[model samples]
Target chain A: MARPDQIRFRRSTLGEDVYEALKGLVLEHSLSPGDRINIDALAREFAVSPTPIREALARLEADGLVRKRPLVGYTVSPLLTRAEFDAMFEMRSLLECTSARWAAERADAAHREAVSAEAATTVAPQEDDPDGWHAAFTALDARFHDLVAEASGNGLLRDGIDRLHAHLHLHRRYFPYAQASATVEEHRRIAAAIQAADPDGAEAAMREHLARARERHLAAFD
Target chain B: MARPDQIRFRRSTLGEDVYEALKGLVLEHSLSPGDRINIDALAREFAVSPTPIREALARLEADGLVRKRPLVGYTVSPLLTRAEFDAMFEMRSLLECTSARWAAERADAAHREAVSAEAATTVAPQEDDPDGWHAAFTALDARFHDLVAEASGNGLLRDGIDRLHAHLHLHRRYFPYAQASATVEEHRRIAAAIQAADPDGAEAAMREHLARARERHLAAFD
Candidate 1:
């Protein structure tokens, strides 16, 4: 059981708390895709009434995170098929490439330097420690792209791009074993292109990197 | 008053009902940007408990459609200023141009014919009636771009584009008087480019059209 203070500090509503708990289960694969969620059990475990649980489930349904049957209630949304995964990467590449291009044109000296430093932190070889290296690279990669979105000076675009990235991250954890070195090299090239203020080069580099990543992920499934 | 059937059909949970109702109010501009939303009165009007209203408000807060103060409660989000609006259009121009390029590459004969028909409907002079012309042109314009997104065969891209279009439309109602005729002509050219399957031409046409639209919208603010 969570401490009372911890729960209070989270400042989440009952519905939101329920949603996050359920989403965590899905993300960790403890609640596998297409598995029906037992709402009654969840309500009992959470020490909350069923109404908030139902509301949370409906909200998740709206988000495409869960699906509901007419009489059977909700289940976790399925894992992305290979084609859907590719489509997701393609969308990400398009938006992120544009974001990087805009950032190259708009980023201030401080922002560019910070991004470069973050990228540098991920460049050292960690061949013996794939998981640690992957975690570091993922954090740096997200920060770099987020910085680009902020530099683009479009809140709406940034919000949309961020949401898509979050949704994609759920599926990304499964492919941690695929070509970490090449992934790091691609990130280095993307950072270098942005630092050079080469918008077209940055766009091309990011697109190629995402395309390669998608291929690698799909290859693992096969 | 809405029909009894409509009301009955809507009776799922109080939170869902309040959410749909508030979204309608915002989309219709009945609750204009920056207008204060009184939660107590809304709860009373809906004849539901305050908990559901609070939950619905929280969701709206997450969606960026409403602003919540620490103690002052909620209000409708404000309209974007001229600069913010221009930035949004810049992003839209990029995404839409890419969509047009993809559409030109992928659109079949049937899709091309449908877009061409919509474009034709939009091009004839309705110059004397700016409001009616704007409405007609806007609907046709939405169909043209939506078709392009659909033809791209990327569901993620289509969903992102649709959401951006919706958020952008909230401010579009303010731009009714700005070179609406020239805008229609530009759409006609873009449609022709798509019909001819000219990828570069379609992209260029969309870029020019969006640039002009941005200028006109900003000029109106000045």
Candidate 2:
């Protein structure tokens, strides 16, 4: 077994690795939004041919992190505008709030335990530990939301939420942790609602959380 | 201007053509559920190399119409089970109901006219015109639903609902239209709700319609 810090590629799929690497660059803002991606240039930079890069780009395009034009090739997706951010949260309020409600109604003991465990373990990223905090926060945020979506017991709905969350993360990278403590508290309340099997409470809590989150992101522009 | 019946491929993108052709096969039941898709055979059938075929499969996989395995290759996605169908409808109820509500609140006069026109013009498929009916009904059904989603003004949510409806259509091909009149009537009621700007009414109408649709599909299994 590899150690926790050890990097392992069990399958060593080049295309997948390239996809991750490219996604990292995007998330880290090295490959900035709306930047045109030159396939041949990326191939040369990665010291491989164009095939893997193209495959990676295709997957990224499907993920909504990249866009492809008919004759113009691919470019990094543009950052979300204020209106888009509002639209995103409205959609999230509809989907994730419903997810929370369903989780309250449908989550089994195992699901409750899993969500509670995550809520207990996750900590707010500190100001000084920017890189480490970013990584920790991203993982925790994804897990917390993903578990709620999974507990909804609707695979298709869960998938849609997951995709939207992925695109949201791209915009999220621009903002710092202004309301981390509030976020943690909100997650606890959401989890508690679900654990208590209060469907309406869970839905309301989730909506409140997302509304606050939207405010936090909106404040970034101001 | 080209006629509606005319075939037009201005760009002649082979991958897109293959994707549409393959999707048509799946919709028409020429490519049945759970059937393994041989890439080489598809390449031969299309008289093209493996690249475009692989691309088409990748897109289809993203669309949830097809599945890909590591060593086993591609296959038509298996039929949705009873539980999945129920779950799918539950998710759709959440999404499309929200869409209907938003369409009521947000849709402009043009959107209202488009939906009203579809509801008014679309007739139940005749007994002797199964194929023509299928094609016409499919187009009108998709357009009606899509117009509502578009009116929601949330591209992400609209895309999610669109994808789910696509998968639902795959299952819908198997069941004969037992209540096409009910469907048309339901559509009219939904349209009327939106046109009247009654958000709650629209949402309720959509949910009721989906519930009835679910019952119809469930009856198919018996």
Q: Pick by DockQ: which candidate is best?
A: 2
- Give the 10-residue window scoring lowest on summed lDDT in candidate 2 chain A: A6-15
Q: Please state how well chain A of candidate 2 matches the true chain A, as a TM-score.
A: 0.88
Q: Count the backbone clashes (under 3 Å) in each candidate.
A: 0, 0
Highest TM-score: which candidate? 2
Q: Chain B of model 2: TM-score?
A: 0.90
Query: In model 2, what lDDT does residue A149 have?
Result: 87
lDDT string, candidate 1, B63-159, tens digits: 6778766456689888877777777787788688888888788888888877677666644446687656555666666776787777767877777
DockQ (CA atoms), all models: 0.30, 0.43
Tens-place lDDT digits, model 2, residues A105-184: 99998998788777777665577888778777877888998998898788887887888887786574644466677788
Quote the lDDT for B2 in model 2. Answer: 71
- Tell me the lDDT of model 1 at B91: 73
Model 2 misses residue B114 by how many Å?
Answer: 0.6
For residues B130-219, could you state the per-residue lDDT of candidate 2 as single tens digits? 877877777777888998898777887788788888788567464447677788899999999999999999999999999988887777
